[model samples]
Target: MMTLEEFKEKNYGKRGNTERDELEAGYENFKIGALIHDTRLEMGMTRHNLQKK
Candidate 1:
């Protein structure tokens, strides 16, 4: 089995610094978008309502 560091480097580049940064940034946005999307659904919000907010 590979170590965690090895896996990260293999998938995310050397030490995963660069790719990890990109992944983190994208994930943060994704999380925010998901939260907003879920909240909108719960509130029965339409696209227009979301736009107006």
Candidate 2:
């Protein structure tokens, strides 16, 4: 099986390629969103509650 880095390179191009950069940025955003969602859940907060605050 190919390594994760090898898979990424094969699919998204090299680290410096435009598609790879965009993919990296999108992944970062997804991670941040997941963190926020998890933290909110841990604090017993819903999306509606945050919107009103």
* Clash number for each model: 0, 0
Which residue ranges in model 1 land beyond 4 Å of their true spot?
Answer: 1-9, 14-16
Worst 10 residues of 1 by lDDT: 7-16
Superposed model 2: Cα runs more than 4 Å off: none
Top-TM-score candidate index: 2
Candidate 2 overall Cα lDDT vs. reference? 0.94
- For 1-53, candidate 1 gives per-residue lDDT tens digits of 99976876778877348877787689799999999899999999997998998
C-alpha root-mean-square deviation, candidate 2:
0.9
> Compared with the true structure, what per-residue lDDT tens digits does model 2 show for residues 1-53?
99988999999999999999999999999999999899989989999986787
- Candidate 2, clashing residue pairs? none
